[model samples]
Structures are given as structure tokens and as C-alpha cells.
Target: MSYFWTGEGGVPGDFAYGKIHLFAVAALIVVTVLMCIVGKRLSAKNKRNVILVAAVISLGFEIFWRGVWIGRGVPVLETWPLYPCNLAGVLVPLIVFTNNKTLKEIFYVFAFIGGIITFVYPDGIFVNSVLNFSILKSILQHTAIIFIPVFEYFTGQFKPQFKKLWLAIIGLFIHLFNSEYLPRYFGMEGDYIFLRSGLPFVIPGVPQVLILGPIAIIVMFVFYAALDRKGSKAALRRKKQ
Candidate 1:
């Protein structure tokens, strides 16, 4: 139990990209593809239910994890609203339910790209930890971030316009500002964006942290190529109408 919550007797990076990690990603991709195959056929009620269930799970795990962190005596500045995944877990639900197209333009990218990166690499966190509460919570929460937006797209709910790319850039500016200044204001040492801190996931000589901005921009477009979205806007509009 202590291993589950407190991580008292666990090894770090135990499952990073091992079989379990690959299996998990494969499972999610399979489910996402299944959803894509039958998304348009699903009823509105069922779609809403699916979204609601995922949102609750993501938000619930985030709260639980935060409680664990606080209970374990981790600093608040370092834990809450600090990282991209943190926001993706905590805020993405609110953005979606509120139907905030603008925030979606920003966070949908976070939910997809940030979630994929962290979920895949998870170096210091999930990579090494045995299957405990921390690992379960981390996996579920990360899955939610990646799953929700992509699921929405699969269901014809979100049609991202490339011209709104600036919205995400501006959102990242705010994120970077908060990352650098928030901890300083609180008199705590922190690296929320992983920009100052060396990233656990790597690109060898190039600092992986520097790539986040460009990656964010690129992924806003890649959902099209990656998902094989054909006439996404027209399809989405036709569905909505």
C-alpha cells in the first residue's frame, strides 16, 4: 500500500518504454481507432457520456495525486498547476465542458502532444516504478489528456483550424511566464516547463525542452496527417449542421 501511494519501495523508470508502456500506448491507439471507426455512428447521448466519464476520471485522479503529493510533503509550487500535464489533467476538462473553442485551440494541443510525450517517455516517474497507485494514477491521467481531444476529433466534435495557431503560441507564452515567475514569486526553486531543468526524455545534443514550442505548433497540424483527417472542417460542419 505504501508502495502504491507513497512510492516507498519502488524503483524509478522501471516501466518507461518497456512492454507495459508499449502495450498501454497500443491499447489507447486501438481504442482511439475503434472510436474513429464508429464515432459518427454513436449517439449524442453516448458521446456526452463518454466525454463525461473520461473527464471525471482525469480530474479525479489529478485531485487524488495532488493530495498524495501534499501528504508526502512535496511543495505546492512544484506540484500544482506547474507542468503541462498538470494543466492538461486539471484544466482540460473545464475547457472542454465549457465548450471554450479558444482554450481548446490551446489545450487540445497540450492534451495530445504533451500527453503523448510524457506518457511515452515518463523517464523518472512511470518508467521505473512498479505498478502502484502512483503509476496507475499517472497512466490514467496521462491517457485522459491524450484520449479526450483525440476522441472528440474522432467523434466529429473538434475541427482544429490551422489559422488559430497563434492562440496556442500565446497560450504557451502564458505557460512559460507562469513556469518561470510563479515559483520565483513564491520563493521556491522550480522548473515547471522543464526548460531550465534538463528533460528526462532526450534528443541528445539538442535540448528537448526547447522543442516544445515548435512541437506544439507542429502537432496542431499533425492531427490531420497523423489521423488521416480528410476534409475535417467540412465533415465537422456537416455533422454539426
Candidate 2:
């Protein structure tokens, strides 16, 4: 139990597919669906407020978690918010509060992909027991990452723009640069975005993190295209009436 609160325990070993992982994923799906339904039912003003609250809570936890790591003597560089998921944590509040359409579009695609992948195949934070604070926090944080943008889409607050794919790519470049160069310059060993080596489950000789951005963008484009095609068919049907 002290290990849960205190970061005194050694870092847990690599994640293996397990029952807890499945339960966490299932819970995320349920929460996401419920949020979408409630968001759709809410008045526009209230929906925005809901989003604001979610963003605040998500960012707050992220900062708190980092503080815990730092207090426990973890290096600041290693825990910097440079990973795609951590970057999303910072961006969510900006998107929700400022209502920046461009940022929202950029965050939506990246968050959706990153959140899904992280939840599905978690690392470092995964625990055999659900009672662990790390596991609970991981589940909640990733859920927010997946849910907020999806809720926005359901409420018509966001529209997919394939051109914004460039924004995600740019964000990736910034992370990669920091992960690669900052450590060498500072004489510290840090793997911010895991650019040097992929996640635990990744096969050898594959640049998983490097390739993930382009793959995510392509997937988003295909999803947008399918939605557009469906909308076109509906419009044609209505026009024929």
C-alpha cells in the first residue's frame, strides 16, 4: 500500500496482457460511451463547462503525478511532459478553454490514437492489481484522453480536418528533438518519447514511435473519408426525395 502512494518501490516490470488490463479497457469504453451520451444531452453551455472541468482535472493529475516523481528524486528531464500522451494532457486544457479550433483538430487526432493505443497496450503504469494508485491513475488519465475529444465530436464541437495532420507531425518533431538532443546536451539519460527504442512489446528493428504518427494520421484520414462518404450518401437521398 505504501508503494501505491509513496513511489518507494522499484519500478514495476514490463506490462504483460492480463485480466486487469482487459477490465481497465472495458471500463474506459463504458465511461467514454456514457460521456458521449450525456454530452449530447447537455445544453451547449453546460457541455462546454463539462469539457472545461474534465480538462482541468486531467491536467491537474498529470502535474501532481510529475510532482510526486520529482519529490521522489526522479530526474526532471526524464519526467518532462514531452511524450505524446503527456503533451495531450497540456493541450487538452488549452483546447477546451481557448476553444482553439486548430489546436482542437490537432489534439483530437493525436489524442484519439495515442489514448487508444496506450490503453490497449499500456506500459510502466500497468499493475496486476487494480488497487494500485499507478494503475488507477493510468486508467483515469487515459480515459480522459480518449473521452474528451470523442465527446466533443459527438456534440459537434469538433470537425475533422485532414490538413491538421501536419500539426500532429510537427508536435512529434518537437518531442523527438527534445528526447534526442536535450539529454545529450544536459549529460542526462532520458527517453522522453521512446524514440531510441520502442515500447516493451514492440518487435526489434521497428521504429514504433517514429512510425506511429504517420500511421495515426492515415487512419484518421480514412475515418474522415468514410464519414464524408456517408454524409454525401445521406444528402443524395434527401435531395432525391
- What lDDT score belongs to each candidate, Candidate 1 first? 0.71, 0.71
Local distance difference test, candidate 2 = 0.71
Q: Which regions of candidate 2 deviate over 4 angstroms?
A: 7-15, 127-130, 198-217, 226-241
lDDT of 2 by residue, 168-241 (tens): 56655665676567667778776766656655546577777646556655766665555356654565588799
- The prediction achieving the highest lDDT against the true structure is 1
Over 46-155, each residue of candidate 1 has an lDDT whose tens digit, in order, gives 88777877787777777778887888798765676867677778888777678778888776775678788886567555545466776667677778888888888768
Write out the backbone clash pairs for model 1.
12-128, 13-127, 13-128, 14-127, 14-128, 15-127, 16-127
Which regions of candidate 1 are displaced past 4 Å?
Answer: 10-14, 75-78, 127-129, 199-241
Q: Model 1 residue 32 lDDT?
A: 77
